[model samples]
Target: MYSSHIKSVLEEKMWLFQLKYFPFYAEWMLMVLPFIWLITLPYWLPKFIVYLLEGKHLVIKMLILMTISLLTIFLIYMYVILGKPNQEKWKNVIFDQHIKRIAIKIYDATDNMIGGLVNRDVEVNRGIFYVERVPPLYWDVLKFREDKYLEFTNGSTGLVGLLSSPRAFNGIDVIGIPSAILHRRGGGSSLSQQLVKNFYGQDYFRNQTSLNKLNTLLRKYKELDEAKTFYHNLRENDGEEFKRWVAMYSPSLVSAGSVYGIESVAAMVFGKKPKDLSEFEQILLTNMYKYTHYFNGKAHENKCQKIKNGSKIDIKTYFAENPTKVEALIQDIDNWDCTDKPRVPLAFYKSMLAEDTKGQLLIGNPNSRIWDWAGTSMSILRHETEKYKIVYPNHLITEVKITIDTPKNISFKDSVNKAFQNVETKLASRLHVNLDDDAKSEKKQANIWISVVDEKGAIKYIYKRGNTHDKRRIGSISKIFEAIALGNRGDKYDYFYCNEAFQNLHNADGSMGGECQDNSQNNIYSARKVFGASKNLPMMSAFDKYVVKDNKGIHLIKNKIDDEKLQEIYESFNLSRDNNVTLKYELSFGLTNSTPYGLQKSVHKLTHLLYEKQLNYHEAHIMESLKYKIVKESKLINGGEKNSLFLKEIDSKTRKMFDKNTKIYMQTVLKSALDSKFNGTLKGFKSIDGYEPLFMKSGTTDKVVNEKKLTQSKWVAGAIKVKGKRYSLVIMVHSENGIGKKIGHHEIMKPIFKEIVEALNR
Candidate 1:
């Protein structure tokens, strides 16, 4: 019965272990099995029995049980402390209360500082709960006033308010002082020491004995003799100390402004004194203003002079001589009256002197010219005469000649008519106005005359006109002729010719006779020699050799002639004792062939050659390569229709490859060409012949035709067209000089070429 009861009790204890720790034992069987075995011997014996045991087996069992029990206790304690086993309910209650308190404080502070209501306020009597609400006020309002601060408060669980208040008490007021001062003061120094350091240096109060002596001397004599003596001694004893004293006591001697405690010294140095308090303030203020304004104005004047002179004048000497000019000019500009009839007043003139003369004095009329009103036209003229001495001196009044005299008690209509008449006959040409024929009749009827000369004996170029149709036509025709004369003419052709011709037509002596002829040569000679050599032969070829080659291509290479040799040939040609017959022949054939038109045509050909090369190269690389035999057979069979048909087929196939490759290459080539030739070095060459060389490389590509598609598209169509058609070629030119207008030659010739090409293809 006793054994049975003991077995029953062991069974009940085993069942209790299995129920309480069975899952953990199963999961950590390897970890728990040894510990269970270690404690099993003690578990079988009573605690008192185990303690009484003294044999080796009993002692070992007791030791093992103690080790296992201690280990188990340690693990359980760790689980309780670190893992918070069985503590979630209590922890949640405590943490919720803490969070609620913090949230309430934050909300209250935000409402107190910022004038706004918070959203989703929580009532936190015991614990915390999450609630969604609007965001806090934005920070941008800080820009309005720095002193403002926002406070937030939670009145209940779902409500909040933001109030504005001073930032000082809420803990952010000490941020107004400059960062430099704050940083130095934060380094643990007394306020008095900081003040001294700001006015003087760190060593000013370091010596107590010296400071005491200075204090006693200042008290007795109202002057710090000890301090003065110390500084004097430092001047003799230490070179660096002497420099510091000089810098502090006499800054104006070595620099330009007063140093700390040096205002009296500065006055003494300048040998000036104030009679009264106001006088003292005024003198100091005036001196300060003068130094700042004078030096800065002088610098600005030097800069302006440098810009005006560009690479010609030295700025340092220029400013030294005329420091006050820039300030005067700026003052004048600021005071200018833009509301006057001409929108220019006395101040405008003063500013104009600086701008126009660039500091130089004006002795004659500066405002009379077109440049005073138009900057672009002025720039154009300036560029043209950059090497010449053209001067606009000062403003001058002039009397102009009119076509009709002023009538007595003139009616408005009559006055208008008289003005229009003057414009048509005299003023219109100069002013660039156009009048109709009916306006001329009004001029004759009104008896109006406009003076073309000014009070200063200067000539006026512009005129007013009457309502007569003829007078109106005179102005209109003048503008039309001006436009036509300026179009597409070569640079070598003299503008003086057109100007001279216009003057002569008006029965006036030509203004260009001697000055224009100084640079001019016989048109025929220039055309035959210069144009022929530059375009027909190699650019480096001699005139004589090129002339010889003109009759035939053989003489050019045989002569081995160049530019140096060309000069000699030209001199020889000049010395030739040619009769009238020979002269006529040279003039007609040689000179005329080298005319501007001929040069222009030659340049056009060169452009065509370049285009051909580019197109061929692009087509060859970018097009689908067809077998030569196929193209050849197609061409042979299609004989009469070969060129057009072959080009069309090749173009279609090439267009596909254009997408895969040529699109990018074409863009690159176009941009390079535009940069290199159109917008860069070639920009100034507006004349057709001058632009010819840029396209020369393109012509060379025609000689080496390799791809069937290129041959078909470029050669077949181009060759056929060249043989049978006289296609009109168009050219475009751009210029910076503004000597002439832009020309779009292609726009004019497109229709002509279209008709010719269409007829030939049909």
Candidate 2:
């Protein structure tokens, strides 16, 4: 019979192991055990009476308590075993207490705080994640190893009682910590740090010093530091941030089958905020958190009774003492709205900020198109709730100060957002409306590219439309190239032969007025005059013979039209510097098509050249790409020796990319552009009133259709200086009805020219 009893005991212990260690809600089953202990309280009374008489009964009872006291010292361990913190019979029990207005003044004081956070423009810049609203009395009553003031210091389980344990709602790991202590246990840790860890999880913590401390005094002070921080947050955020802090701790089942935060639970229980709850209601709520419940009193009645059984204070008469507080709270339940939503004020806050941060964009799109990278998460606000991720904004397009000079007297630096919108709208609306308007217009597609460069050469603003990629011919604009090429030709040639066979344009002459009458004659003209007339035939004729070769008839290919030289030229001109643009079509010298972007970019370079500054493409870019990140990685470089060596190697290559000769040659080409006395090609552009054109060039491409040569495309591109500020412009018009010389200026291109001019002249 003794062996049988031993076998039975072994079986019981194994069953207990499964219930304790396995992932089950066994806390519900074991909650009944606490009630058994309570039932044995009467048994203890008889033993106590016997001990007073014989003393033997006292010895037996003391011995039993000693045997089990080592394993189960804290009241916390008793409830935790059942997979929860409360006995099951009484799921949630409000102690039969003499509930009184103990903190009526405190409750009244916080009411304004609750309202200001929601209704007024309080400083709610920071979001409250979670904090518990534990009154001082609750902390006082925790039965553990007492400190100097008889306050508990978590004697049994301690802070590490629960490790990073996963839980069932809102993805918050239960952390084995009683959710109450995590939030309300407040202070030395910064919100910036805890926010990071709470939202991002414990894995985000590089140094879990908050959890690592073993010394009692040090840990207590550490907790006090966190407490102070949270208290300050309550005052600063008007308690809204702190309320949210309380919410995340124990995401309780406040309604049927749904979990919500402390704020929502308060609104659910008393139709008010935690700050507005009466002392009686506050105590009831705090006790209920020991084992989270679904707002219904029936589901948690056993735990409620268990709470009453363990209380040291007298509460039976206390319940009768304040019927009004209880009655009013129950009346609130009659009109209560049960839902899992943030307090109305916090919900309003997230909504207001949604629109302002949507324009924030991620930088890597390359197209420079705006996208709401923050999305619905409002990641800028949310991301900081954890550690400050260093790479976030850098990963977004970085913001650097850029200066802008606009025709409208607008501050481009301060108002670039408006510029981005207006420029895009004007271009998009023009293209959208005009492309569908005239049946006579066969312009397949069109685009415009405008960019402003600051004094420091930073790109302040850039605007683009369709056809920015494809290479469309820039006809007479090639004159600008010929002029620069000739000026930089490295050979001294006074005159170039203009043959009569060169019929550049229909019924038009590109010859010097000193001699030429018709295309049947041969003439010699100055190289500069060839450029001003956009005398395509003469320019092309002079190009291969005189421009490319010296007066001795030897080819002057100093900077050969090879890969490196051409790339250098393109880079200097800002023409198709990126691989996104192509330059497969060789320079025609006004023979075939070239990109409009290429032409505009060349004019842009001329503007800089006029200012006596230039972007050194080859060397500047190479060093810029390397140097951009140096400021960030300054520590790794140690000293200036390595940086000096890197700079020394690039010094010689960058020396002459924009030397005096190149600048002089470019400036001469720019000056010669407006010298249209010979051809009068650009004189017809009176479209920009009161604004004198500094220099100009026009281009057109023709196609023979039904034996009639109709103009396929027309372009007028140039630079104009107005109000001491310089601006460059490019215009392109395509029409099947003929967009040649007259139509380009009159129909499609002139209005846009006028808009730009008007803004600048204003």
Candidate 3:
């Protein structure tokens, strides 16, 4: 009973193994079978005997065991390969399927002139059906037969050299068959054999990452397996099959349309037919099968040498065309650019087509990168048509579709120009900015920046009113940056306002400028407390402790910003880090400097971060992407809609500007500042009465007048939420008229925003 059970188990295992991976079992055996002789040779027995005479019985057992294992492998190999159908026996295999009908459609951009009502057959387009395939053994391809001599037989075609390795190569003779088979990748395959596999290969084993034979084996197996069923049914004795493939795969005139077939490429590249190629020219043509770019579109000495070595033919012979004039013609072709396609334009190639239709319009010089998107798309259409071939009688293609999704909505240039002019006029008339003496003065500068992005994805921006990209000292709006500075503290240091850190910041008389109203000793305030008051003293102290880390090298604060996060913030703001923002440890940073073209861009980024909690990260990002796509395809941004990044030109340069990760921690700190009582800089928000609420931070600074007194340069930067829409508001206004007395964000800057929001809402 035990013996019967073991026999059944062995039989079952063998049968299942053979059934599952029949092809690998056969091919791998064909690779390793010859090496089995090393184990089974009778010579090993003599060696075992000699070893035993020398008292080496261990070696004898090892040899005997090795022989048995080898025999086991050899028997399995014999079973798989010997069982495979031979060439002669393939004739008996029958496939009952009828010939496949193929439908052809021609496209010109998004328009289709052919197909649908009028169906076209694949074979009808191709002229000169294939007569027959010369037997592989009869093909004689000799390259560089001798120096300056290239030769091939009269019937030899380009496929012979493209597909086959040299005939003299025998893996078993060069090196043992096993090493050669594994290393050389099965040596070579005849052109016809390769063509059969390429056309029918099931691609079951094709892997993106797999290399060489492992990649080929599974595909070959599928091909051979399919061939077993279809070899008798499918026939390519006529040129129709060859023409379709050559047109589809080998030829490409313009990539913009379904321009297929070698006839076009041949006319465009060589200005001649494929059959008329000289021996050396044919060598150039065939080697192109490996890489078109390397040989055809490159023209350096290295490129020249690569083609010479790859084809084993001389370039001089190829360029000369006449053997006697080889050396003289070498210089002529050497100077030629590989991409300088034949002078015959694409229109000429179309004129050659039997279809009475003229080809698609050719734009740009043919030498430039031809549009390849449509050409690549043809394969899918072909595959789909094949699947439904029987349903579409006469292999009819009713429709050929081509869609190009390019960026549109060129620019919001016209609307933006008119809107900003209105904002400037309203501000000047309402705020009464004085343009009298200053307007006539030497390049007197004033910037009117009105930038607002609505919830509906429209961006309206007007930079430095006069010179948008020019530099200007932006007023107290710089104070909000303290949120970033405070986040980088060494320890949770209390705002020690004892005036100890302010000694270096003393005025000419040794008194600090603008002392804080609260002069309490040892009264430490949180960073948030200082930010609300816009205190410059502790702000400078923090900068020294957290940023510069004073001369004594003592870290008065912890949680200092690391290099990486600091870099990210700096980049987001477009702030210059290489230049020290301060004069020295004792230096001061005021309203602003024109280090970058505009301050509005930086403020806009900060305000974007304020929306984080209210914003759905995925929804915002995907909507941003989808809206951009929709607008790009549709060429319009629906006005009054919400959830938009903005309407700007379609460009990749500004895409990274919409970062949700811009200022995360600062958002938490700023929220409290905005909610603070409407006093100091934010006093202006109270004037904005509407259905919407305000979240904001403000800054106030005065520009010195006559170098003795200063005039207020009021500023307010924030966002207003009305309905479901959010409009970011940044207003920087320096009155043309001098301030008779002190003013805050409420008077000039705040009113401008209130009126602008009203204008936007209407």
Candidate 4:
């Protein structure tokens, strides 16, 4: 009895193994069968020729002639098929030798995009998912649901009714094969053929005319030939481990609207990675092979209905608490068999489809650094490709990996967030504005931007709750540049003739306005006092008298010493790449427009120069050596090629813009702007840790509203150094009402700076 049982078990195991490798055996059969039949031709040819010459055994002669003709044609067809090579070269274009996608990846210092180095506010518009190998459940469900004869068939056209219509001998189904041949059409395609069509065929085989049908069959023959090569290649490369990846490349060609590929579909529908898909989800995706964009959920609605509401929970909370319970719940909902016909409500499917169509079905946050880096990397790709004239379909470039050279420390991000929340809460109460209410009117709302960068111009932190890119009348921040321009021209002191109409220049009553309260008497003030106090009229007079050249006694500021020097300064700092810089004599009192990014970059450039001035050759060489050591050790530990640790340095021309003496003098003048008696913008700011202030400046610009002059822009910019590190900071605020209204310095900037100081000190 034991022997008999073992015999049955062995037989069953052998049968299963053959069934699993049926495609391989079938392809070999097609390849080798012609040679086996060739032997019979030699034996039968002589008899057929004699009978035909005698004209006696007509019946026998006809049968032999037909047999010889069929075998000869079959041999010729097999020879032609074997001669063709693989045309599926698109993979080589998209992926490198390691099979990793050939696209630029942005990483933070830690080489991770979604790590805790930044805020978790990323929102991806249409995300893509990538997997090393597809799950077994996916293949099982796909084969059983898509084409039951998938194992036995090569990816070629059906052989039935060959006399009525042309076809390839590909499908090897016991039942469907005869039916397809009798009907003079193909029954279905194997997964390999589906992949071929998805990647290369559909563009040429869309129409179904007779000519198109013949071409399609020819194409199918090539697909079968390529499938044979692919199977061999996959086995030679990695054995059967990556067999499931065969279908991973089959994108939805005709059905899915904008989405393509299994990875993208999985991300779009379930917001899950390919490996994370439940069995039922795999089945549903298998059904999408045919219905794609038009796939209604009615077929599997009943099985998935149990977890419809559960899926709607906030994703953050879903993964945070009782993860085991969530997994069990998902498993229970996915427990249904793929063969069971669903008969449930269609609402769940409809809701998901609605979300997808509206572009609201997201896998990651749009406000994240991931998306920011993605946008930048994509632009880089476009620029590089266009410059070199290398063009390919954009869809082929789907996968990416991001690596940031200097990712922010996670602790730093947490500190920034904590400070930001405190500031928001304080401002909400002080302004009496429901900042959380989406329906609030625009006039009642206020916006703020805080940007920070390292001395090398790499952004370390940014909090943008406003239109930071919108051009704002920069007011007094331009004074920093004016100071540098004057210092460059060797102007030490000498200014007078303060304008009496400085402050109320925009008043609707048409009376000449005033800029500085101290300039009421048109008094002559020293240049140091005028700049330190931000006395608009005296600064204007200094520019007019010493900087501007008299042309026909008009003394135009344009094309003069001040204009040329300021333009040169802007270029050195990369402030205006397009030459949109417009400088006015009233620049110190707000006459030019600049974005937050532009302002931050200018400060960043200055910080670089100041930092470099402190570094001796020995210290600089030691720092470079330390950086190299860190990078090498990281690669040795992490086990892959890492991003280079080289930071871009200031060019020679930019460094030459300010001599050592002039830079030192500029810093001295800027420090006085923060003193209490003059332009005390930093008076409200508190010191943090060992970070000492290097320089500071503030500006306010006015706008006419309801026939009254109102503050439109309030900005403060500065730099600080601590522990051998330098950082540039810019804070900009905008309001429809003046800053003195519901929100003021006490309620907003002061408390915010205080909180930031406390956070950083920790």
Each prediction's whole-model lDDT (CA)? 0.23, 0.38, 0.38, 0.47
Off by over 4 Å in 1: 1-558, 562-762
**Tens-digit lDDT track of model 4 for 356-467:** 4223222122123233223323332233323322332222222223222323333333455565456566654344222222444443544666656556544445555444
State candidate 4's TM-score. Answer: 0.52
The list of candidate 4 runs beyond 4 A from truth reads 1-112, 115-188, 193-447, 491-529, 532-534, 544-562, 576-586, 614-651, 687-690, 722-724, 735-747
Q: All predictions: root-mean-square deviation over Cα?
A: 36.0, 18.9, 22.8, 15.5
lDDT of 1 by residue, 228-274 (tens): 22222222322233222222222111112211212222222222222
Output the worst ten-in-a-row residue range by lDDT, candidate 4. 619-628
> Per-candidate TM vs. native?
0.14, 0.40, 0.33, 0.52
Per-residue lDDT tens digits for candidate 2, residues 538-641, read 54444444423243542322233334544555555555322333232234334434555456545655655545333342111001110111122111111111
Assess candidate 2 and give its TM-score to the true structure.
0.40
Best by lDDT: 4
Worst 10 residues of 1 by lDDT: 711-720
Q: In terms of lDDT, which candidate is stronger, 1 or 2?
A: 2
lDDT of 3 by residue, 73-110 (tens): 55543332222223343333211001111222223332
Give candidate 3 regions above 4 Å deviation. 1-445, 455-457, 460-464, 488-500, 503-523, 543-567, 577-588, 591-598, 613-665, 668-679, 691-695, 700-705, 734-743
Predicted model with the maximum TM-score = 4
